[model samples]
Target: MTSEPAEAEPANQPADLFDLSHNVNFLLRLAHARGDLLFNEAMGDLDLTPRQAALLHAVDRCEGGNISVLTVVTGMDRGTLSEMTPRLVKRGLLDRRPAPGDGRAKSLYLTPAGDALLQLARQRTASLRERVLASMPEEYHDLFVKMLAQLVGLETETRIVHDLPTVTRRRT
Candidate 1:
């Protein structure tokens, strides 16, 4: 019997590009590195890293919040807070106490010094943000920020910040 012509296989691009350069994760990392450079340059007297500023900013938004909440919202591991929080306290920028509802949870509050520094950080960071978005189409700025928020929000939700193991990689 004459066989019908075999159906042609539909050609399709890969579901994910194999090249690292084309990977979204690599792109995000590259973007983060570029941002760090810009942030460091603009930080000037502030000298806070992007993550540190973000932590402080989150605390400001919380008004009076606990480490558990901060860890979830800030995407910072407890070890990170252990290192940075003490320094912030030493610098008179942060104060900690037992959470109102839960004594086991440590609550964080921004000091007047922290408030002042936050305001200045906002100003400096605004300038840097503007510079970063300068080359992008002005209309895309809102979309860019929104998209990043969506990505971060989704990623943060998936992570169980409290489930971290005790041992940390040695920094060297």
Candidate 2:
């Protein structure tokens, strides 16, 4: 039998090839999980998820804010907002009124209770963000936020109408 030399592994290979802690996708997921954990820990007593709080904030901020406007601002899908709106209404945190021009559409507003809770949530989350940023270097703060915004296309605008491909059925 002929003897051949074994190939050498790359010098820069990681200690564990499967270790994904530094991977972009893995890190994004971990960061999201950590954010949720911290948010829950800070605001769990308020009985609102982060997204719910965001929706309330959006409703308060968006001019003539309705579900469609919220979808654009919050990046939440229509179906999700549709489902979430009623729950908040049930909790007495939101008031849904028929839009002036559109009877079928709803314009959302925060109730007194919702506004109070949202104010508290905003303070807590702001403090939480400060703490989170404190853990990282000051120089990286803006860059970090900018990078995340780019990832999510935070500045992208949604169009009400777009071209659609026509589909034709083939006769068999």
Candidate 3:
């Protein structure tokens, strides 16, 4: 009897040799976690979580913003934002009101206190970012941003390709 040859695994599999994509993804997660920890530590006195800071910043930029807009801007889910919004409102950092055009939907606004906190959070975040990037040469910053943007664009394209068939079929 003749034995059939075994199929080769895909190059991008976890067991593949020298997979730079997996290595880069792992490093990205690690860096993000470390950055979050550092940012939270820096904002400890101000009592602002990173998500809260982001939400406040979004509200400051888009006054009378709806929850849908916040979800898009912050990439946070409705449930999480719902939970956080009440707390922020209670703390006088945010104002939540029913939308004038849509009574069932609510809009978010940043109070003066929220603005102040956001400014402080920006300063803290900027300081932390500078410290992290200090070892890298200034000339590399633009290049780094461009490379990261390319990676993001590629990922977005892949997502669109994967989802387009399902989305189109759903409409039919």
Candidate 2 residues 1-172, lDDT tens each? 9889899887536654446854567778888998888888889999999889978877776534677777776778999999999999999999998877889877788899988998899788767887667778989987887788778866532221111111111111
What TM-score does candidate 3 reach? Answer: 0.69
Residue-wise C-alpha lDDT for candidate 3, range 40-93, written one tens digit per residue = 778889998888987887676556777776665556788988899999999999
TM-score for all models, in order of appearance:
0.74, 0.77, 0.69
Off by over 4 Å in 3: 1-22, 145-172
Superposed Cα RMSD, model 2: 10.1
Candidate 3 or 1, higher lDDT? 1
| Maximum-lDDT candidate | 2
Which 10-residue window of candidate 3 scores lowest in summed lDDT?
163-172
Candidate 3 backbone clash number = 0
Q: Candidate 2: which stretches are off by over 4 Å?
A: 1-19, 156-172
| Superior candidate under TM-score, 1 versus 3 | 1
For candidate 2, the lDDT comes to 0.74
Report the alpha-carbon TM-score of model 2 versus the true structure: 0.77
Clash pairs for candidate 1: none
